[model samples]
Each structure stands twice: as C-alpha cells, then as structure tokens.
Target chain A: MSQSVNDLRVTRSQRFIREALIDLIEERGFDALSVGEITARAMVSRATFYRHYRDKYDLVEQIYAEAMQALFGAIAVQETVHSPQIWVTFFDHVAEYDRLYGALLGEKGSPWFVRKMRTSLINLIKEFGRAAPQWQSDSAHPISLYPAEDDLIPDVIATMFVEAITWWLEHGKPFPPQEMARRGVALVGAIFKETSTW
Target chain B: MSQSVNDLRVTRSQRFIREALIDLIEERGFDALSVGEITARAMVSRATFYRHYRDKYDLVEQIYAEAMQALFGAIAVQETVHSPQIWVTFFDHVAEYDRLYGALLGEKGSPWFVRKMRTSLINLIKEFGRAAPQWQSDSAHPISLYPAEDDLIPDVIATMFVEAITWWLEHGKPFPPQEMARRGVALVGAIFKETSTW
Candidate 1:
C-alpha cells in the first residue's frame, strides 16, 4: 500500500514537470528554456525537480524514451505484426500527446530530437521486417521489393515516415489517426507496385 | 573586356568562399564555425568576403538559392513537364555537388537548411501540378488521385522526397544519379497506385 502511494506521487510529479516543459518549449523553444522556469511553472520545488531529472536535456530525453517505449510496447502486443493497426496505434499514440510532439518536432525543437526519432523509427521498421518475412516475400510492401544488395530501403521508409509525421504535426494534424494510417499504408503499397513494375 | 574580367574574378572569389564554408561545416558544424575561419581557409581577405556576402548565414543562403535555382532551371527546360529526365537532372545536379549537399543536409547542418529545402520542393511540386493538369487528370500519378479537397499530398510527397535525399546523402549515396532517379520515380509511381486503389 505504501509503495503504491509512493509510485503515484512520483507519477504525478513527473507529469507536472513534463507538462511544464512542453508548455514552455511550445512558447519559447527548448534552447531558451531554463530549470527555474520549468520548476516555477510546475509549482514544484527545485529539490523535487532535481530528484526526478538531472537537467532539462535529461528531462526531455527521459520523456521521449518513455513515450517511445510505451508506443513500441503497445505495437508489440498487437495480434498481428505490421498490420494496419500498427500504423493506427502509432498515429494514435502521437495524437494522444499531439501538443508535446508538435513542440518537439517543430522548428523550435532541436535537431538531436529529430535524429533520435529517425533512428528509433528505423530500428522499429527493421524489427518489423525481421518478425515478418512474408511482408517482403509476399511483395506486400515496396521496401521488401528492393534488390538484395540494396540496403537503403529501410532508411528511405524511415525518413518518409518521420517526415510525414513531422509535416502532419507541424500542420496541426489535418487528418485523424485513422485517416493518417490509411494514407500511410496506401503510400507503402503504392511504392511496392512502382518497384515491382520497374 | 574589363567587365568580363571583373565578372570572372567575382565568380572565382564566391566559389572559394562557398567551398571553404562547406569544408568548415563538414569538419566542425555550422555553429562552431566563424567567419574568420572561413575567410582564412578560402585564402581571401575579410574585405573580399564581405564584398560577396553579408555574413556566413547570408553566404549559406545564397549558395542554396543559386543551387536550387539552377536545379529548377534545368527542370524547367525539360521538353516534357514532369518527365523522368527531371529526376535525372535533379539527382545529377545533386551528384555534381555531392559533397556540398551532403554537408548541408548532414547531421552537423542546421535545421534552417532542411526547412528551406522542404519549402522549395513543395513549391516546385505545386508548379509542376499547375503546368500539367494531365499529370493528375489522366490518373497517371498518386498525387493526382488525392481528393481535390485534400491538400496534404504535396506536403507528404515533399517530406518524403527531402528525407529520402537526406538519407541517401547520409548513407554515402549507394546508387548513381540515374539509378537514384529511377528509384525515386518508382517510389512516386508506387504512391500513385496506392492512392488510386485506396
């Protein structure tokens, strides 16, 4: 009972800090942000802040790490790998924290964050490719149709996925998660056909 | 005769300065670089550098502007609008200055450059769409298949195109210009088919 109470306190404090950071970043960008401002905004003491995060960068990093882990975890538990539901889950996760993501991926955000997202997306894609050989063997996707010697397909798809999300978020997400997922799947399918014909 | 000589000298000085900027950016990134270092490396005096550019940012901006202008100019001259030759000219132009582009779009480069590239590509795409309605009317491409009310297709395609180039350059460009062109076209064509069937 005591441990559960402690965990709840920790979660609440972290959420406050994270929300504060997102609001501040959206207003003034990450570079100009400071710990004092974040703590003040979150109504938390400096000691409390330090207890949770090493610094602002560490705070942002932890937030991204936790969010991405949660996202991937959700996708992992899906009944089928690389299903349309995967994209739906991915976009839904993004939409859940739309404001935070928009700020992180906007012009105000750091390039380091963008690069981190790209790397994570690429690894996720490669993992999908491994788990489902049929995704490639069945010619269901364009990435699978690449020549054996060419290894840039993953990079290409990852880039596209990241940029699409960035563009969507930057534009205020004109489409809902389901719509985005549909368009995304259609894009990959289109690429597959183009590759096979070529 | 004197005017032509002055023009030649001006062009030579700008080239030296631009090359110096690329080399310095590749080595230490844009932030760590200084105007003094650029001028010293170019073997030009401060006065000569200022005569050609206001500052480092201006210099970088002008370099991209000229390169993009040259690329669009080449594409504009193509006998057929949206022809395969356009991609060939683009990839070829990129290959001609592979080192410069790689440096600009690489990890060390600024986000400002990436944003600029995205906007330029989006505009270029819109221009093509305007010049040739058949590109869409005949259902020849995926972008054309997008519902008239949906405007995100240009953004999606632009993001994909920009990110793909960035990835290719970062990966040391595994394929030649012609090959890259073919693959790029195939990717676009694939998206078309996906959109049509969806």
Candidate 2:
C-alpha cells in the first residue's frame, strides 16, 4: 500500500511538470522556456523535476512516450485487428487528448514530436502486420497485384495514416471520430483491396 | 542590340549570385551565411546584389521560383493527362539538380523549402484537376466509388507525392529516377483506382 501511494504521488508530479512545460511553450516559445519556471508553475521543486527528467527535451519525449504506451495498451486489448473498431479506438484516443495533439503537431510545435509520432506509428503498423499476417502472406491477397516492395509497404501505409490524421486536424476535423475512422478504414481497404478479407 | 546585351548581363549576374548562395549554404548553413561573403564569392559588386534582390531571403525564393517555373514548363508540354510521364519528368528534374534538392530537403535542410515545395505541388495538383476534369466530369469515373470530398482530394494526392519524394531523397534515393516515377504513378493509381481512367 505504501509503494502504491508513492507511485501515485510520482505520477501526479510528473503530469504537473509536463503540463506546465507545454503551457509555457505555447505561451512564449520553446526557445524561451526554462526549467525553473516550469517547476514553479507545476508547483514541484527543481530537485523533483531533475529526478524525473534529465532536461526539458527529455520531458517532452517522456510525455509522448507515455501517451504511446497507453494508446498501444488499449489497442492490444481489442479483439479484432482489421476492423474499423481499431481506428475508432485511435480516433477516440486522439479526441481525448485533442489539445495536446494539436499543440504537438501544430505549425509552431516542434517537428521532433511529429517525427517521434511517426516512428511510433511505423512500429505499430509493423506490429499490426505481424499480428494479422493475412494482409499479404495469406493466400487471398496476392503480392504481385500490388507491386510495392516489401520494405516500402509499411511506410506507405504509415504515410497514409499520418496524412489522414494531419488533414483531419488541420481542417478543424469536419468529420466526427467515427466518420474519420470510417474514412480511414475505407482508404486502407482500398489500398489492400486484394486483401480486404483481412 | 544594347538592350538585349543588358538583359543577358543581368541574368548572368543573378545566376552567379544564386549559385554562390547555394554553394555556401551546402558548405555551412543558410542561417550562418552572410551577404558580404556571398557577393565576394560571386564576384558581383554590392551594388549589383542589392539592385537584383532586396536581401538573401529574396534570392533564395527566386531560386526556388525559377526551379518551379522550369518544372511546370516541362510538365506543361506533356500531352497525356494522367500518364506516368508527368512523374518521370519530375524525377528527371530532381535528378538534374540532385545537389540542390539534397540541400533543400535533406536533414540539415530547411523545412521552409519543403513547405514551399508542398505549396507548389498543391498548385500543380489543382491545375491538373482543372486540366483533366475528364477524371470525374468526363463521366467515365463515378464519384461514389471514391468517396473523398472534392476539397480534400488534391491535398491528399499532394501529400502522397511529397512524402514519396521526401522518402526517396532521405533514403539516398535508392531507386533510379525512372523507377521512382514508376512507383509514384503506381501508388497514385492505387489511391485513385476507380478514377484511373483519368
């Protein structure tokens, strides 16, 4: 019970620091931000901040890493691999953290975050491919029909997903979460038409 | 005859300045470069540099503008609307200016150039949509089969093309120009399958 209490306290402090950092970055700019002000705003001491993160940059990545861990954890529990449910779960996750997503991918936001997100998405895509090998290795979806080389297929899918999310965000998200998920699943279906069975 | 000679002299001087700027940017970076060294390297007097461009920023845009104009010029001559020929012409242009493309889009390169390239591509895509209304308006390809809204379609296509080129360049351009063009067209075809008739 004491260990659990300690863990909860650590989590609360970490969240406060990350949120404070983002607020400071948006208020001025990342270049002008300082660790001192971040701790002050978060109501945490400088010592606590240092114990949790190496520096401001490390904290930014940690925020993204935590989000990815939660997202993939939710995805892992889903029963179906290729269903629209997978995308719906993703869209819901994005909606839940809409502000953070916007700031992280916004025009003034750091490209470092966007690149990190892309790398994570690529890994998730590769994992999806493994879990559901039906996409190609299955007898139904012949590889010759869609001639993208083995190395490039995952990247192409990843780009499609990234571009889709980017458009949804930039356009003020005209479609609801379900609709966006629908369009995404449809597009993926189109790309892997021969393997739609998956 | 004197007027023609004056025009030729101006063009030569402008080209020299632009070349010098590109060389220096590759050696160091655009942020660290100075107008004084640029003039010295180009062997153009300060008077000539100021007469041609208000500053170095203007000159960089001029270089990109000229490249875009030339690319569009070459693309304009092609007869077919949806042929792979368009991408081949593009890949040829990138190959022709391999070093400049590398500097403009590589890791150390500025995102300004990448964004500029994207805007130009979006324009080209819009123009292509206009010139080849045959894809949909011609009545051969129905709208229902491909459900992307009209406004979003051009942006989607533009992103795909940009990401593909960006990938090719960052990967040391593993595939030959012709092969890259082939893959691009094939991917575009897959995206706009029902409308492939265009």
Candidate 3:
C-alpha cells in the first residue's frame, strides 16, 4: 500500500479502538475494564492496540484531547470587541460538547477528564493572552501591571467556570445550556473586572 | 478489655494501617501500590486489613474523608459574617492537610486521590445545601439562582469552592492559599448578593 493509504488505515484503526473503548467504559467503569477486553471489543490485534496506544489511559487521554480540540474549535474568535456575541459563541461552543462534558464531569466521570479540561483551559487562556494586545494594555490597572506574571488569574477563572458547568451537569443542568453559559461568562467577567481593579 | 479500651485499640490499628498506606503511596505512587503491600507494611493481617477497609480504594477514601473533616472543623463559623476572617480560617484549615492535598492535587498525584476529592466535594456541597436556609428564597431570578434548589446553596457553593481549589492545586497554585480562599469567599458572596437583589 502507498504511504498515504497506510496512514489512512492507521487512522481508521485508531478511531475504531477509541470508539470501542468508550463503549466499553460506558458499559463497565474505566477501572473494571481491562485492555485485553478493549482489544477484543475493537476486533483488533494486541499489536495494533499497542502500536496505537501505550495503554488504556493513553487512549482515554487521546479521546479527551480530541473532544477538547473540537470544543475549542467551535468557538470562533472575535475580530472585534463585542462581548455579547463572544458570550454567545462561548455558550454555543460549550453546548457542542455537552454530552461528552456531562459524562466526563458527572459523578461516575473520570478524574483524567477534569485534569485534561483544566490543562486545555489554561493553554487556551495563555494563547488568548498572547494573541490579544488588549491583555497587555496599561489602562487595566493591576491586571496591566501583572498580565503574564499573574497567570493564576486566568487559571482560577477558568477553573471556576469549568467547575460551575460541572456542577450544573451533575445536578441535572436545571437551566438551558445557553443560560448557564451566559451566567458563566458573566461570572468570569465579574471576577476579571474585580481583579483588574484590585 | 473495657468497651472504650477495645475501641481505642481498634482506632489505633486503623490509624497505623492508613499511615502505612499513605507512606507507600508517597514512595511508590498510588497506582503501583497494592492491598497486600499495604497490609504487610502496616504489620496487620490481610483479614484485619479487610475488616478495616474493603479495598485499597476504600482505604484511600477513608483517608480523604478524615482530611476533609479535619479541614472543615478547623474553620470557625459565626452568627455574623466577617469575610476576611472566614477566609483566613478556611486557608488555615486547608494548610493543616497540605501534604495530603499536595499529593492528591500535585502533578504526580494519583487519579484515585483526585476522584476521591471531587466526590467528597460534591457530597459536602449537598450537605451544606441541606443545612442552609437562604437557599430556599423564591425571589431569586434564574440568572442569580443558586444551582441547587431550596436550602442547597451552601452545598452548591462548597462544591464550586472545592473544585476551584482542586484545579488551582493541579495547575500550580499561582496565588497564596489565603488569597485563593478569599477569592472563593468573594465568588460565593457575589452569588448570594445577586440572588438577594433578584
């Protein structure tokens, strides 16, 4: 087979394995399921499984990364400073992964999912800080004085947003996703506003 | 032996087992450790170990519960609110279990530990909601409403606070513990303030 065809085959196999693992996990908890079971379910050879993933944990991480990338990608960046549209985009983005997010953040969810989400959010904030010149302006007072230096601000805010969303999910998400997202955006905005003043 | 004396003996043995397990986790990492190893290290019989804990996971959960109880007990509750004092108390409480918290929330921490923390936090929040009266007010708007239903605000806030703290620990606590606690108080306070107005 040509190199491109081999690559496509490999990708297809990886996707098959990942989907199988998720199905297995949903049926049996992550701890209860063994990797041999995963391979058997995927109808793949042990060698193929090992070649694609170091272990079940690695495969889980890969699935989480794909979910995060897809979630982040859905949120289009604002070319201009329009807070409401940005908020709407943010809500829509979160809604895209609501099912995965619910499973990952639910009572029976894996801690690896939360950890992956936290890391992704931190990276996203750092990327935003680097790309947005407004984050560097002195007009913001305390925040301006310590933009990159106070990386904790973004980390804390991101954490709060994620936790609030998780809380909503585990408790049945009483409000519409858009409404929850709106509240989340407002909460973070209030936090940043306070910190900048401080 | 007297009933109290027998109780004391059982408690001491349990403590010894838990301490041994923690030491093993610190040295070998939680994933690498086993129930047999914990029993051997604690100098207790496998029967005794089983009597005290169903499994390694159960033992870890007990340790987590003890740490949380100690931390929560350390916080002083008053009839009237004093935000800064409350924050100071909360930080001091968390500092008491810094080692366990650090091990659980640190980069090299165990997945089991992290999951235990999240579950405990959720339970704690539910308990708080059950105990807090202000959460039941009907005037609160949907935008300002606490995530939990009537009398569940405390539980919701507690979960949110713990999740934020856990995230901070995993991502590298950028701010001092006191500052983080203060921020937590402020976040909860804002939610309450908004609800009252609504």
Of the candidates shown, which would achieve the greatest lDDT relative to the real structure?
Answer: 1
Better of 1 and 3 by TM-score: 1
Q: After superposition, how far is residue A166 of candidate 2 from its true place, in Å?
A: 2.3
Clashing residue pairs in candidate 2 (N, C-alpha, C atoms within 3 angstroms):
none
For residues A1-198, write the lDDT of model 2, one tens digit per residue. Answer: 134656877989988988887787667656457899999999999999898789987988877777778887887899886555888889878877766776666554655565567666776666555555444454554544334444455566676676667667766777788988777665655555533322
- Rank order (by TM-score, best first): 1, 3, 2
Candidate 1 global CA lDDT score: 0.74
List the pairs of residues colliding in candidate 3: B125-B155, B129-B151, B129-B152, B129-B155
- Write down the DockQ of candidate 2: 0.27
Of candidate 3 chain B, the 10-residue stretch with the lowest lDDT total is B142-151
Question: TM-score, chain A, per candidate?
Answer: 0.77, 0.74, 0.70
B51-157 in candidate 2: lDDT tens per residue? 87888878878787878788878887988745667778999898777777777665556555665677678766765555553445445555543344544556667
Candidate 3 CAPRI-style tier = acceptable
Q: Which stretches of candidate 1 lie over 4 Å from their true place?
A: A1-17, A31-56, A130-150, A170-175, A196-198, B1-16, B31-55, B129-150, B170-174
Residue-level lDDT of model 3, residues A110-162, one tens digit each, is 76666677666776555544444343343456445345534656666566556
